[model samples]
Target: MEAMVNNICDIVLKRLYMPRVGILWTSGNHDFLRWAPSGELTWVHYLSGDFTKSSNHANNPCYIVESLTDPYREAKTLSALIIPNISLDFVSKLCLGLPFTAAGSLVFGCLDEQLPVIVDDTCITRWLRTIDPKRIDEITSRLCNLGFIVISKIGSTSSSCVLELDEKGWISWCEIADRLSGIGVVILKNGSRLTDEAEDRLRSLGIKIER
Candidate 1:
């Protein structure tokens, strides 16, 4: 199960592109600073609202900072650290308060900035096991019965399932469409092949194929 969780993390990381450097907002004192790389922490006295704006203009800016100290005082001195090469491990450690629960949302919320952020693997695994567990189990069982060796859910939505095919042979969507009733998207990995008939069948059934 641990191996499967890590594999899913790898798949999601590969599909999402992130920047090398990112801004991390924190209200914690310097005690929580060890998780970050040396000399990367920068204390800011004032941050213009413009700094919160991402490269893409569509993302709404969020700047909430929770602190144990005086809320008004702390807000003025919130530290916005420059994180280089951010990873799941770093986030799991540094984001001490409600780490796993809020980490995914925080990362996804900052997509427009191309933040070097990723959803913690434990968080993803927990969601998979907790949210609609029976449905997930049924889906896995059905997929395995259909000869799928690798399967994982990448998004919270029903359509976010991914199935990796063996590098060797072509697969026909007609052969598996009925079994995949709730799945709306399929990502083909490792140079997997899909016949023209499969493509047509999948599209006709409102299933998207991504290679």
Candidate 2:
């Protein structure tokens, strides 16, 4: 069965061969500093002529693909994918003036258990901070399953949100309260409050919520 599947895939690939696109994920910090793709590649040349001279006028620029004679020649490079939590500010710099298109996904805290999650035009973004339609649509399906409220921020369509966390496990008791006074198995819930001595002991230990 596996051999048959492999053979079928090979046949299909041979019939419709597509260039394997490579993606270098950028860490948002890289936006501050980074160079161009290093490989056996020539400078972008437009068929009409070099558009580098005309800055004020809008020109349709295209790159002339150059063949690499030495495949092993190294052009020290790095991936562009980055962490949103830390690198929110430099997104623009990393994506601006680059040759490639940008796209991204978002995950977040959800609210409804049944619906579980919601993707809107609020959170995600591309390297260039433009909306990417395909990415947004793909994120929608993933969020519904994963339960994250998300959005996008990149492309022609503009940026949009994607997914978020579900509503079930919101918060825990230990999160809000400052301290745990005692470990009594059973006690009157409201009637029994933290005693003065216990509060003092907790305070000494640097606990905020004594009782």
Candidate 3:
């Protein structure tokens, strides 16, 4: 009730010439900061509003498809589908010319899982330039199943990135080390220390850690 009253009061003040000022009201402080359909991702947001049904928009549709009732929604599409939960700030940066494919990977692959993830959009921009549209649809659908929301681009897209190994990446390194057992092992971690799992795997293979 207080929120409603504040919203009404804000509207009245705006009509009284608040001048170049506006605000968003959500249930929480984080939500208030996140909703930015106002000016962020101008084209993408507009297309979603213009395309999605009024009813669906009211409910904050989870998947803003090109057509809600199409039989082959998985095949072709007009605009990149978006999930409404993404921060408006993120959408704004994306619409400002980030690699759509890499952004898809970053948000769905790393960010959605709350994993410690980093990205270099510049590298992805060059590495993946001509991905098949069907591949994108496949990736998008899979990511969605994993509780991720994506904005997909049609036609060819490009993205590739490689991040430095971090403490969190050790488990993956261990898995790799396990596979290298038959091929003989040479540990080459410079200043970085091995993850416990990595050390265990190498030791199991009778390899000794100098460090």
Best model per TM-score: 1
lDDT of each: 0.40, 0.27, 0.33
Instruction: Indicate whether candidate 1 or candidate 2 has the larger lDDT.
Output: 1
Summed backbone clashes in each candidate are 0, 41, 3
Tens digit per residue, CA lDDT, model 2, 83-200: 3222232233322322222222111101211111112222343322355646534543443334332323333232221111122333233221221212112122333444455444
Q: In model 2, what lDDT does residue 5 have?
A: 100
* Candidate 1 TM-score versus the reference: 0.26
lDDT of 3: 0.33
TM-score of each candidate structure, all chains considered together: 0.26, 0.17, 0.18
Runs with alpha carbons beyond 4 Å of true place in candidate 3: 1-175, 178-183
lDDT of 1: 0.40
Worst 10 residues of 3 by lDDT: 19-28
In TM-score terms, candidate 2 sits at: 0.17
